[model samples]
Target chain A: MSPRLFRSRPARVVPAVIVAIVILAIAAALGWVAIAAIATGGSGDSALSSGFSGFASLGAMTWGAPPVITAAVIIALLGLILLVIGISPGAKRNIGYRTEAPEHIERFEVILPTSALASLAAAAADSVDGVSSVRAASNASSTIVTFSTPVRDNDGIRRDVDAAVTQRFASIAFNRTPTVKVRVQRRQA
Target chain B: MRRMAAGANRTGLIIVGLISLGAGFAALAISFGLAATAAPGLSPDAQLQPIAAVFALPFSAGIALVAALILAMIGVRWLAVQVPRKDSAKPLRMQEDSRSGVTTVTANVVAAAVEDDLEATPEVVDAQAILRGTARRPELILHVDVDERADFDTVVADIAERVACNCSQALGVPLSAVGVEIGIARSRQRRQRSVQL
Candidate 1:
């Protein structure tokens, strides 16, 4: 990935929105509760006292009721979802690998997009004999090339495709060379 | 720092949300008579006592302060994450003159020129350059959009070579790092002629 693309992380809009809404709701609730406490002179007379007191209590919680258990489960599930979303590496835009420049060149890096890699791989695989068509998918770690050929020996085509792709990848000075895999199937007559 | 803040933002929000959500649901559940039989002796009025007492004294103010701080923290991180950052470092000296005043240029200016030059290329549709680090040792971030049919490798190499050469000789500064991102431009649709009868 380009350092610029990686360094300039995209804003987590969904998470940010969730956080904003939750925080605002909680802030509003706290404000209301605090106001109610002050309005009632901290007396046990306020209507919200029941909810507030229950929350403030540090004693062991009674978990006998079905409604309480159900509510707890739902809330726990929601929290788990949020935690997963927050902690997990979310969807990332495809940015290609950072490649080393040619020898005797000044310090510079070229980021080749995954699309470009796939294109290059497909082009290389297409050059092999008996390969009717080629489709390739690539990322920073690996490239998978699948081709259809009408030839008798699919295995030979696969090997040829693999070798061609390997050669192409070897020529590029990628920060890390991706493993190449080739799949060949006989084309339908 | 931005990445760290981003991670913290998510963690903090999820943690706080879980606590608040759990408490709210628990209170509602108890009110609805779920597991209400377990605490046969406890009443709705009774639960309020612990909370009221906690918020009655200095603890009330403290809770309020903490709540405000949490809200502020989430809010600030959300805003901070939205702003794009280019790493800042030392400034590069462009010229040194004994009799005349010394001349200097920021990495940003060099990057802008490079961006403009790249965009001027026939194959390139648009480009942006973000300069990072100090003046003497700058890192260039080049993002370019090229004609979809253009030769991807050749265009990238051409842009890199041009930018590196231009910056070194023109700006007289050695770059510490350079990174480029290339995007294929969408094909333009041809317009149809309108006929007036």
Candidate 2:
């Protein structure tokens, strides 16, 4: 379940589905209109035969003027309603894909076995194209692998350097993965 | 499941929503029939029709609207639901984040995996392994080159397996954290092979 879905309000769908179900209910009423007329003729021949019997009774309004038309409308509406209800759960499930840990791991660290791997990682990283200089001796835990590439293109250069380092180190095990920070040392375009 | 349906509370709200939806529809049907029947001579003011009468009630349609909204909410209800359960929980997760934090997962996984690798082969004389990961960058690990006489492929396979296992264990952590870096390469002469007899 995606935590993001919770952030979005689901209130918007109801109006649309309700309007749709109502329209469906209305169509359903139309589908049953002929049958309603017939059934009403059979049961309430005195009513429609009497030509739009002018609201003669509350029971007409309470249940339905011609009963079966009401039944038709109700049945169709109920079916549509059930569909909307049934689909709602499935819809939410469809767009949901992310999960967040409730406990929230704020910070953690792992010590590396040696600085040699870090240096090699730095060396291999510096060798990549577009890189201007490697801040191998920075006090920072991450390598400030500066790039000669343009600022706008620094992202691409950084990715390339990162990829190169990843490939170079693919066959070995290290305690920390070098984070290549791309700073544009110089740029032409 | 029943408990889940009600926001992990009693199923009161959902039931209420269900009943209200039904009632609202029933009311709508009745109102439609009344209006359709009274269509001929209904007051020209257009407000006298029973459908109009029902709509005037305000609360009923609102209830139906509420029911409809509730029904819509079901679309995300499952995802929004925070159930404390796991059916197919994998022991490892390899989520890569471009930060030093990812390095920790890589390290843990790589370290744990080294043991697994050692268990598989006989000639690995206490190999040392390193691993690290970052989101802004790809992961890296240093396998401290060891046992000059050992088969390379076997060593590689052992380290890879260890990295993969640790990667899975560290959900959201990358396998690249396990870099087989040879921090020290000392040729320790083979001690007397302990006879297991």
Candidate 3:
């Protein structure tokens, strides 16, 4: 197996499950109608024959009938929605890291989720000497670190927090280094 | 992470979508009298008796039953694939020559050993591993949770150099591929107790 450097997209499980259920339901209905028709020997009053008779009533409706047009429109829209879901790639769930290994051996690919990256950034920022508390959020492209301190001299503390978070991210060697943004808030001691 | 039936889902969606789109468009076309040229009596106001009359045929019930069975099979297959799969390799035959003796190792056994080794690493709170590929070209995939403040680079390097080398040496074959997924552990609840004073 080769290394997979790219992030994996989420499987469209919900849509797939729904579609499968719909198919099963349709199959069940078809089976029921077929059985009813077979048992009744295709009599006019049989469920399947009656079902068709009911459908034949729709022939009385003009092409411009509200119900006919609405059903057609709804079916078309449902198909369009399914097509879109099938084509669209879902959200990426992890960020790949650059691998560093000896040339003779296969390099190990590393990955981290955005939530984990954010936690790492927050931990690094919290460890900064003057930072009393910290919060961080990360995406594929960037991370924002926000820290609150009870110190009046916050400029240096902000820089230190920024450096700490940046160093942590650098050590991970992410394939695409997310830019770090730091914000500091001051509180009375 | 386990493998998903994404390809199957996409294919199913595409097939269903095309059928639905075609049916809807055909209905719309007939409603608008667009199909009048092909079937003269087909119109929005046309009696559906002619269309529904096919079901009244002698063999229509058998055809419907067959179609239902086919649809049911498709539905069951789709539902079955929803279960996640690991797709791990089969038991590895590690013996140099089968004439002398054969040694077989299950993927789970190797994966468990790798997980134990990973958890032994400093600051790694939890670890999971899966071994794939043949014995000659093995692949290892690991997911490890380490303390947020742990040195990320050192831990990664340790896995790449030490853990992988140890596994390769044990198997007597160099790993063809290795994948590590790192996560941050905020809680110390699962941390290993090194010393009990």
Candidate 4:
């Protein structure tokens, strides 16, 4: 079993695969059409040539037709989706860290996944006294801790949660320390 | 795989997307009668004599060439995908003999041994290791799930120290980097449930 499983970015890969498939299909279709046209001595009445004539006749298509409008909308939507994916800022999975040892030591880096960070945050939050339950979510910039309590004194609970989370973050020498946000809410009975 | 796919295909996708978008918008505008200029080349009803006149031997040859190139490009991309990623690190050099040839150990084998040893530890419920990079400068990525009651820091530091020593001493390949990902093991009581009709 390999521990170093490479993470995939669906935002980029899915659209790319779609585009590739579309290109391949078009190329194949055009190739077949070309072959048919050549075999039929460039006859306009040939099946392949007639089929392509439909595409070549697209300019004369009326905007009032249901099918044409639908196609235009679909095509435009697909393009918009692709454009959004291309422009969006991609999320990186690993956290960078530099190892410190003796002088003249070899330089190497370590990466921790966001899942690990979330687990650490959860563990830290769970240990707090008034926190009856804790749910932690972490991203590149911050970790948000949502805790509930049966009793009042939200301020006290918040202070404790902040201290615990801060201490946990301080303990680990992370390359990028995410800001911890604690939300103390009343627990449901 | 997602990372690999994106790295290989993102640029081509953007280009194709842009073209599709532009063509789609152009079609919509033309159909709506917004543009004043006539789309002569697009309509089959037009006098396609000029374009059709050029579609003789040279057009056939060019289209055939383009079709072949497209298929070839797709084939190459497919072939490149078939090659597995470089997962296993460089082989550890063991015994070098005059007659029996050189004996080497694979990184996966060492990783497996380390995983097994770590799993045997009291604090660790499960463990996995992946070795990557050259043997001279290898990286060890460890995923260790600790017992719920176990101290997180203690378990992590213990696993790191032990794995480093074991790999260095046994395989004679000091790790250039070690990444430890700690997870809390789920309780067995919660997992085991009885159902009755």
Name the top TM-score candidate.
3
| Model 3: CA > 4 A from native | A1-7, A42-47, A50-53, A56-62, A121-138, A143-167, A180-189, B37-39, B186-197
**Clash counts for the predictions, in order:** 11, 47, 0, 0
Please tell me which predicted candidate would have the highest lDDT against the true structure.
3
- Can you tell me the CAPRI class of model 3? acceptable
In angstroms, give how far residue A155 of model 1 lies from its true place: 21
* Clash pairs for candidate 3: none
- lDDT string for model 4 (B47-79, tens) is 323434434434553455477567657745743
Candidate 1's residue-wise lDDT over A60-166, tens digit each? Answer: 33344444456667776676676666666654334445545643234655666666667767777877878888888877678899899888757877888899889
Chain A (alone) TM-scores for all candidate structures = 0.57, 0.29, 0.65, 0.66
Model 2 ranges off by over 4 Å: A1-146, A149-189, B1-54, B57-59, B65-69, B72-156, B159-197
| Residue-level error in angstroms, candidate 3, position B112 | 0.7
**Residue A110 alpha-carbon offset, candidate 2, angstroms:** 23
Superposed by TM-score, candidate 2 places the C-alpha of residue A6 at a distance from the truth, in angstroms, of 24
Output the TM-score of candidate 4: 0.67
Q: Write the per-residue lDDT of candidate 2 for residues B48-67, one digit (tens) a residue.
A: 24543442232333334444
Give the 10-residue window scoring lowest on summed lDDT in candidate 3 chain A.
Answer: A44-53
Score residue B104 of candidate 1 by CA lDDT: 67
3 or 4: which has the higher DockQ? 3
